[model samples]
Target chain A: MNSMTSAVLDEGKVVLETRQLTKSFGGLVAVNSANYRFIERQAHAIIGPNGAGKSTFVNLLTGHFPPSSGEILFKGQRITDFPAHKVSRLGVGRSYQKTNVFPVFTCFENCRLAAQAQLPTSMRFLRPAAMYKEVNERADWALDLCGLKSRGDRVAGSMSYGEQRQLEIGMVLATGPEILVLDEPLAGMGKEESERMVGLLKDLARRFTLILIEHDMDAVFSIAEVLTVMVNGTVLESGPVETIRASKAVQDAYLGDGAEAY
Target chain B: MSRLPRSLSILLSVAIILLGAYPLFGDVLFPNKHAFLMQKLTGIMIMAVMAMSLDLLVGVAGLVSMGHAAFFGLGGYMLAMLSPEYSAANLWVVLPAALVVVAIASAMVGYLSIRTSGIYFIMVTLAFGQMGFYFFNDSKLAGGSDGAYIMVKPAVEILGVSLLNLGDKRTLYYVGLGALVGVYLLLRVVLASPFGRVVSAIGVNENRVRGLGFDPVAYKLLAFTIGGTIAGLAGFLAAIQYGFVNPATLSWHHSGEALVMVILGGMGTLFGPAIGAFVFELAKMGFESVTEHWLLPMGAMIIGIVLLLPKGVGGLLLQLFSGRSKMEGGQ
Candidate 1:
């Protein structure tokens, strides 16, 4: 598909733009100066080897940790210094590499909380939250999207690894972000589960903007319209799948070193 | 239409009604010997309010404060200092003034302490409580370590006729009971509110709360301040009931005692701390009457309870009720 067609398919419009965003831990730089843009309504993938500072980039973009120096714009507004939640509300939602969820809460309650975040005020005391129709409806919608409708009452911690990963994504989606950042949505899933997840993710891209971080080459190639390859916290290459696949440098730096092992 | 279980609700309402009418029945039930029991019950009710306030932060918000008693004691001392004569003549002026002072003090403490989390939060609160304790203990102007005595009880006047005499044991019992019920209802309202859900969510996962477009720190600070204010209210009533105030009221041990009460009854349940406070105080009183080594038995009981009942008394009761429901469903 052409870039415009891909953009139209994904409802987001240049939701996140970063210029020379950098973060350092003491003398060692975790994420060097890098410029990137997540276009409106597209499944953009960022693939890199270990220690490529991909997580750091996600952290800086999401306001998990402040950047040393750079500019980040969300929906054309500067949000470099906004706290994590503020960035999220600005239409940038992210899922963690490590599953972060409310373990004790049921799957339904977890999603309900995410839905509740968008409410005008979470400070309304004197009314039962469960009785709120909007919250329940939205939470159910999220559960349906994540394919966890039947497991709504199950405690989050009790879900299988694959289901937990799907729930994590669902939790992020529940926040209704313009740009949904999935930090390895298929990290530890088996073959069938991974294929199922890719199909689900592809379906999601039609309705939402997605910035996917993945090490799974086949999945990335099949789903991503634009692929950005990173090595040591800097972009090695960026282009269509055919262009990236043809690049010898990307192969040598990332794939060539035991493509079979990965 | 089917409703939620009625038995627990019925039991709660019956308990509240019986407690409300305790003053009227005390004379008939116990004859000339009801005064002491009534006074002790009132004291337990006051402590319950204080425990409930602490639970808002510790149990619901996942903030373990070791110095909640500082706010409680500060409330009492503020009232005593404001009413130097403790005369019933100007209770209208004294009570509100005391509450305002305590609220401000607790708010300041919460604001400063909330910046730190985990052990740091606990330590900072403890430090503040100690500072408050020493400040009162060393200051002779507010009667110092010797403490101050209430020469007169504050009376509630309505159209030239007082609804109840503060000096009367029955009247004080009703007042204490009223505070307990009012605080319980208010807390229940808060728990059911969106803000309370956010606070509970923060306890469950701070990062997720933030990811949902909330500043967790801001919510936590708000919860801490509100909890402190409620504790201060309890302190205000405690001083009036006792007719005395002392630096010991703000001591670290008092704060520790409150924590124990929250844990003993159950965390996160509204009435858990109240139940804990009542049982704890009664056990302490009864144990002490039997032996000088009461603390040994108390310590053993706490350890046993912690090990045997991880969810506290409230959770166990919930389990039992839910279990019974399931069995009935099978039949």
Candidate 2:
């Protein structure tokens, strides 16, 4: 009750807070003693070099797998032990690093399946799925939000790579999540696709909290309000985007001379 | 949403009509040995129903269940056990009872088996079938290895006014036809439902389903349960046709044969397996007449079909008639 009240009223408070979160695979400590408090409705970005465990950290935060030790609190509720679906039920939507959508289904159908997950159950057996106007509307809303409104009838597998990537984000949007964790949403897109995605991300930041893992420094600087740089599974630097960008330590250890490209 | 080309759709309609009218016109169609052909067609229809049921798991859900015949056997055994020793049992009563029992049993089996996938899933289901076989084979209460009998068969009666009688071979044949059509329609309805859409999506890619927050396990378990209950219906009809139930009914071989029928006909297209079942049974009969060692030639025939037609017989028909690529089964 207390957490719910706080979550509703306090806009400045953290929406997703993880403490001492650590995960190890055999001898490799992929995420080591990491802590992050994501402010409600803020677009935060996590950036790192390859092998810094950005993807693994996203995996833990989304409950794709359980952490070896730690607690993940959402809206002040301890959800460390929750499974992936349960976490989704609590309104944490995550898009994969790779494009993931129901390939055989139409783009609208793909989002509808995600929207249906918000219901108590899909045990809905007899009446055809098309009759559910609300689900269809939600699916439409997702497609519209992701700029794929015209492609609702096209089979997802038959779609272009950029459109499928948009559909992936659209599916997450349909789930009606409070937080969006996107892993490399622009991994393989050309400049045109990337610009459109950045526009979509900016539009999304107004309504929901976003945690993005991006390698494109141009997109990172334009969209993210704050930046956290990770190195060897530990937070090496974090602050306002410009502050991190200008930091001498950040530049020496990770960003180095390459950040000049930005 | 999945529309087969116009040519294939017409063919499907014509096939259903022919099946529905076969019994009525059997005398004129196969005048030389109408009775013999009727019996064979009836058997094929029963096997087709069973094959269609397993397709829910194999084709739509992309789950390979090797113990599907266990439900088939259980359906037959349930009928035998429910019927009284002397007079015919109430069809309305025993049919529902057998279905309910089979539903619960399959739910349990699905719960255990759905946890595994690929080869592990196949082996687990096969093991479950073997367990059922051994249990019924050794138990004296079930008449041991010799099996049990219905004796009088079931009849549909409303306040003693008889609607149908199973003892009449003609009546039984019609009932089997109804069962075949009813099961087919029910599966079609389910495949279009929200629950079913998620299931097919899981078959295509479970990782994406999970990303969308749909529990793959729940959908799969329900599908397995439904498939099992429908297979039970087929088994009940088979038992009534033979008036007997035996351990062999639930054997692994039956599961393998049903799987072959599903794959040979076409996996996803529901009509394919039904066609496959008719073709398989008829071909087996044809081979047996030519030689006693029909197994050797039968093996060669299946391999040749599978190799030549990668999508099975249904794929060949679709390509020849519609000139379309692989298409989904439902509307």
Candidate 3:
């Protein structure tokens, strides 16, 4: 068993790993010594209360914020200082907590732009957009996956709030990333929409490594294979869903009376 | 209504073709009046090229540059300065030289200016344009504030075989029309390509585009360079058309006029800027003929157009043809 552990460590099975990742804003430390690992093709949930630095942590991981200290490794390669575009091109895709999308563009155009980014010749200026068959195919597939295939013609700005959120996920998926870091995918979602998103997350977990940051305990617990709880810019607990559910510290701090409801 | 109509594209192509061939049979249609009209046509064509170039930056790239006229004037100044009275410059030599110089200058200016966005981008560009204006205004090397007049235009001479005469009004008119058509076709190809999509994406949301694995800065910078280069082409035509170069060409007022042309024509449409240029020039000429205080009527007309037609002439045309109030698929 010890030999197997060493071999797994040697092989670097963890797709994304952060060692002592830290971030500070003026005097306040947003993320302090955040050492985390996300394994391949697994669903990991980062759950915490408001102001718990969960969003800051995601921002650091995506290079939207420079870490105060520590290193980040993706597949054994250090990517601590990689810009968001470079990180994305390295097969790490993400969706914003806010429903951030190309509002002025059509849903199809939004996905198509994302899909085009994944292609080898995205910078080619002479070739027409219609000539890229694979890019369009990927966009179509993503739109269908997000239940937005029929609404592809509609302008994204005109879409309902729930539909816009769905389009956000569709865009991320279209980029053809190996790892998906979704920030509050279910925020402001109604019961039916949340249920639909949960199903989509579960399906996505089977194909791509997903790191979901969410506050909804029920949704997180249902879709998460591994859970990492954070509070006050530090990890409270990290383990399987059942173990986290039974933890006394988590129950007292975050779950409160909602633990029994779950 | 719902989709970009197929007939619109056909109509645009036909319109462009007719405009190009108009000068060919201009004499037959207008009789002796062709020479007088061709002069106006040449001016219209040059301004159209500049306006279209501005639209590339404003419409597609979402970069509102207020110093675009700097590039236009710089191109004209290059020809005027280089081909002084001592040595008359050849058309082949002067044109490429001006393009190269403007390309380099634009790359430098765009590199610095594009670092800031929104209103900052506008301000930075305005500063650069005024700097160019002042530089020319103070320098006696290019005839100082009064500006320099090109004694001789760039003559097309290939191995002592004269092809096109720039001295002839009709030939110059044809050349200007040809250049406009070339620039239009080139932009059409670019807008249909992947780079154009990236530019469009940046316009919508730069951060989202960055998250999708494309650097918005690079695409925006490329667009700035392209826009600048086309404006330079317009400047080259202008210098040849007027046989002069002036500081006023690089003024912020000219830049504002170009923006007005773009907005009045239609923001993102390829053909809109050209139409805007035509309307603007024609309006000025027509109004001047009618009254001494033409600015009053002209300003009112422009304001009316802006208020009544939010999408400008192009959008109105689109709505008329499609028979729909809501025009879908912007650009």
Candidate 4:
């Protein structure tokens, strides 16, 4: 497993790093020369105010957007030029801020599509899709992990929003990623659904390396081993959760209602 | 979207049976008009095959191709060119040649068209199809606007012994039926395959599919090529049936009509488009027999169908057959 060679978050080896990475749309700089490092096995949370470069930063790492300039390295291998599919194949699975599950397909099929991507090529034509025993097992594993095992036969579109969010995470899990990038696992969720997702995240933290972008302070504080705070397309503060919470500069940056939440 | 109801499935099976056994009772059923009716039925079946192939792109892959007839016409042209002036060409030799030529043409067109999506895709494919049309229409070498003809129809022959003669209307009718059935089964199997699941998945959500780590373009191209190859098969059969290959076959009008058939019968279901071809042609003939101006009535009927049955006749049948008519029909 590449996981064996990669850092254990405690072992102090960087799994993903961005160096002077930048993205600009016309004159507006979305992500401006931001440098960030994510260690393996750590649950890292990125928190920022609205319009902060958090989403753009994640897009760069996942290869959804090729940076205007700079570089990204995964397990010390240069991956800045890779496209989204290639980046994903390199064990960097990402869940969208918006729910992106296949709507008309059943929940099982949604997860199956993700699991099927692990196959060397999905160009296989002669054999029936159902005959892939290992892929089916992987899908079941993901579904059970995401707590949607019983809802396997249900169509994704017909499901509640909370359930669709769970399926979103479920799809990323089916990809068997070494490091997971979740844009917002708790956005627009009710208290109970949020708690369930928080519990799921806590459980996942023990196994896979995670990079999360979430506005929910309580969940962030409880789950993250380290936190990176961004403001206006740049990193403001980043360190252990306790250290960032105590920093005067970090406090000043969050002046007003944002400071009270912190 | 799921399984058809038992009764409706049985009804489809009976239709197949009737189509297969029609020749046996043709003389008794139509008497003096038997030969004419058989030829007409054969024509419907060939169109059905073309419609079924187009459904692969429109229904399954969610790629609306406006140049589908370019591939269809190429297949017919292949048969015409391959056929000897004084003797019938061997079916084995001519079929593969036509299929290969059309396959290459479609791959090139698909490769180019895939670069553009949405309305641009439609325009690009149409442009390519029109190029084919004008090339055949303006060039006198291939018979110009008058089109080319196969003087001797293709027959399955091996070692100088003729096994099946497509020149005979009865033989051609059964052959066309065979092609329709073969294409149906092939598509059904393909849809159930892993490749098919990805293509259909592309239709629903391409971005999500890309996020899942599959190259959407490669999948789309493969689906397009397969559809084109099958459409060519229909065109090849059309050439043999009519003993002619014309520029109109490659026209955008032909592609638009085939697309209409796909939407009319039901875009997603294979059986729907084939049934669409059958119904569309019969309706045309019925209208033609009644009035000199058939296009006006046919146009009105198509408009009525699109307005009333948004999912097409195949979709309506799917709802009824799957027993979800009441719950889903209002939608």
Candidate 5:
């Protein structure tokens, strides 16, 4: 995994690059100046303790939180000040830390809405929504990919928590994004569910650029080829998974929280 | 997929056919009854259109407005101002003129109002409605407090063919009915469209919709404009029905009552508002004939209905029929 990651990075395969990204709320600087480059079609896991700015970092990249001063380039094109919708239309999709979905709508409807978002005729007033065959097909493909094909008719709110998380990611997939930002996709899941999500993430990383923020260390280590450890509003270190695991600073700041007991 | 449920589609079709055929035997059906039945039905149809128009904003787009009556009054005022007695016009001339005028006014209002959400949106809409109300109430150009009269009902002759004689009461009644059905179909098609999906999606989770590359404001503004235009049509019918336009048409109370009807019928359900209008208007007439203080019983009945059916009569009907129809599960 490390050799593969370095090879991809060396080949100039960077898809999303941020330079000196900074965000502040009054006296509290949620994210300090951070420079990073994410390789194309690679799973990059961001791990940190509470208030370590991992979420804020993801937010900055995805346009949920505007950086105080920074430049974000997607595929070498400047997207520093683009709104979330504009960024999304440029094929960058993201899921929230909290499962955000149209709860009253069915799984299929939720996916279909996402799929129809970027279509030219999405605003057509007289055409039936079901008549959009491409959108429907994309939604179906996303559902199948997320293992929600059988549960497509179920109302989103009624679905189990783990399934809701899957649906959240599935919605982003339905949008046909080239890059995906999964903000704590595996949060609050049971052992079996987290493992299942980890497997799904591994499979997705092959076809899509994945930037994940997760607290599950085991899952992170299992699937993430590259690791970026954030601590106290700054990036402590970023490198291959093994280098992060071997770093003394990373061990002391995050991995070493209860290392002695283990 | 079917646009409506099997039961609902059948019910809707039967209702439209029955209402369409009502004018044919209207005299024989109620020979001994009051001759004002056709006139009353026309009034009810106008209110139904208004109610449904508001539903597009409140139920589908999640925009609760308190000044929809402004558009209603705008249409009426246009008709009164453009009447033969006032400015010499025909139906073909006034209808589009009124719609265009209302569309511009609604666009201006919606552009400002759509920026606000929830209670602020309601207040903004109410303020706009009052602005229109006071303008007509204080202006002497349209008769002010005494209101203005549209003496000529505006003839409808298309290219020398007398397709509709608006001067006749039966003709006006049929036209009103046709307008009601036409507006209903128009809204139905829109609600089923991709635009409607986005509008409903906005109503659910606007942030999520935004994340999916959809701008909720544009869809919402479009909905507001369409809704306002349809309400303007209702206002035009009302003006034709009574040959009068007044400040009361644009009153905040009128907007409030329309909101009440939308809620009472079911906000998101397309057919609910019309059902709500029917029940509300008929009940008002029934109660008014029996007692002077009709509001007491009317209030109690509405409260009872609200408590009993939280989703409204249309929702209740949907729930009852949806159990047997698997096709309506997602919708």
Candidate 6:
């Protein structure tokens, strides 16, 4: 019992930890008893077949939906039932799978707004916000980082799907979160777009702890340091790429026939 | 120095000069016409300012409130109540005191109402507004249902010369215009600010704003309070203009009227509400002159506008202007 307790304590060093986190929507159990840990500042990829509760897990971590039972610890602090805004303030940022953005605003304005959330007061109505040098500088920096400097003036809804995805990630990055959970960042992109996103993710992983949910095996294998495979609301396997590739359990759950091939 | 377009700026300057000269040259054109027109203009201007304040929340912030008239009525009644007791008709004292009281009242109401969104927000605001109406109606101290009448009007004692006497039609008109212009300028500054962008972003997608690290609720509540405060200012002006404050001032119908004005003019645009207020008031005046059942036609017009022009007259004007610009480019 003492040894088990110490093992749990060791896992606490990770940026995010879930102990028996579960969620049910009336008749359907969206996420079952799931114990998960993601190491600090490391690229952790959660790959799974359809209806594996991966999206549900992301929602739970980001406070989009409350968990039925369990505890979510972020950097040793329990935030299992924190509101979405509180979670964001506590260094948890997430991107929706469905490309959520302020459609009417310019890309720069969108990024600036995202960055402004960290400011002392977003409620200063009388002061001229455009003249705020720090906010302008930060917005410019975020736009440049996301490769949207030239397209900053363009409205978000008018942008191409790939650009919107990039902007979505840029929006998350502007929040300055220690933990970034991206839900299928490369959902509906072509080969080149996927590769570009993978490169961006690789760059991002160096500074921020990343939890990426992806169906794109090539992208996942290329970037992930540690991989977690979920199957039917349960984590089927979790290990390094090589171990995951060799494991028959992982093969049957996720990477079908010829397990060691990848 | 380079300036705004020649035609637009020239037109605006000419209009202002003409309006300023109207009072001076009053007796020359149709004798009593100037007084009647000025009086009508003042009422329209006050209503326009009220509508614009509501637009700040309904249009920009995407909060549909049905209790806004409570603040307006409260401000007006407070001024009416205090004016008689204190004999304070100075703009500096009465205006600020009324505004401050109304703002505090609005803040309290907004704090409670902002907890619920969508239909709940609308219903909650409506509930609070009704409460305000009942309180004023039952209060024997302020004449209860009979309402209170203001004997003194807000005036600026400028170097022994009374600049804005509410009794003087021409003076009242200028004051109303000045208030309208001030509100418009203030709104323009706010809409262009970062806070404005944040609120607009909230309107577009609140969840995104949250993920970006903003507490959308706090910003929204602040906007609600500001909107209520401005509406109260308009109410204060209205009470002084009419020399009366009654239960009708705080009614849901008044709230609906303000919303209609916003919708008729334009929701998101700065000067749209003013345009809407003028059009609505003019339409009502025309309808009343033609038939006794003016409400039927007015209601039909509002319904028609809501159905046909979802973006309002300002949006339609914007579309026309943009289209014209495109045609000019082609030429």
**Count of residue pairs whose backbone atoms collide, per candidate:** 9, 1, 0, 1, 0, 0
TM-score per candidate, chains pooled: 0.92, 0.95, 0.93, 0.96, 0.94, 0.90
**Candidate with the larger lDDT of 1 and 3:** 3
Worst 10 residues of 2 chain A by lDDT: A1-10
Pairs that collide in candidate 2 are: B1-B331
Indicate whether candidate 4 or candidate 6 has the larger DockQ. 4
Give TM-scores of chain A for all candidates: 0.92, 0.95, 0.94, 0.94, 0.94, 0.92
lDDT of 1 by residue, A40-100 (tens): 8878999999889888889898999999998887756778999998888887889988888
**Top of the candidates by lDDT:** 4
Q: Candidate 4: DockQ? A: 0.78
DockQ for all models, in order? 0.67, 0.74, 0.76, 0.78, 0.78, 0.62
Compose the digit string of candidate 1's lDDT tens values, residues B1-331.
0021466557667888988887778889999867877999999999999999998999889999988999999888877877747356467877778777777887788889887889999999999999999999998857999999877877678777887788888878888898999998888878766687789888878878897788888888888888888888888889988989999999999999999999988888767788889879989988999999999999998888879988677656555555455677632
Candidate 5 local lDDT, A1-262, one digit each (tens) = 1112222346358888888998898999888888888888788999888998888887888777778998888877778888888889888999999999899899999999899965964779898888889999999999999989999999899999999999999999999899999999988999888888888998998889889898888878888889999987889999999999889998987888643322
Give per-residue CA lDDT, model 6, range A41-131, as digits (tens).
7789998889999999998999878899998887667889887888888888899899998877779877877777668667776766767
DockQ, model 3, C-alpha based: 0.76
True contacts kept of 6: 0.73
Over B242-320, each residue of candidate 5 has an lDDT whose tens digit, in order, gives 9898999999999988988998999888788998998898899999999999999999989998999899999887877
Worst 10 residues of 5 chain A by lDDT: A1-10
How high is the TM-score of chain A in model 6? 0.92
What is the Cα-based lDDT of residue A132 in candidate 3?
Answer: 91
- Model 3 clash pairs are none
Each prediction's RMSD to truth: 4.1, 2.8, 3.5, 2.5, 3.8, 3.9
Clashing pairs in 5: none
Compared with the true structure, what per-residue lDDT tens digits does model 2 show for residues B1-331?
A: 2546788888877887887777789889789888887777788899999999998899989899999999999999999998999988888899999999999999999999998999999999999999999989999867989999889988788998988877787878787788888888888788878898888888888867876777789899999999999999999999999999999999999999999999999887787888889879998999999999999899999999999888888767766665334344321
Which of the two candidates, 3 or 5, achieves a greater TM-score against the reference? Answer: 5
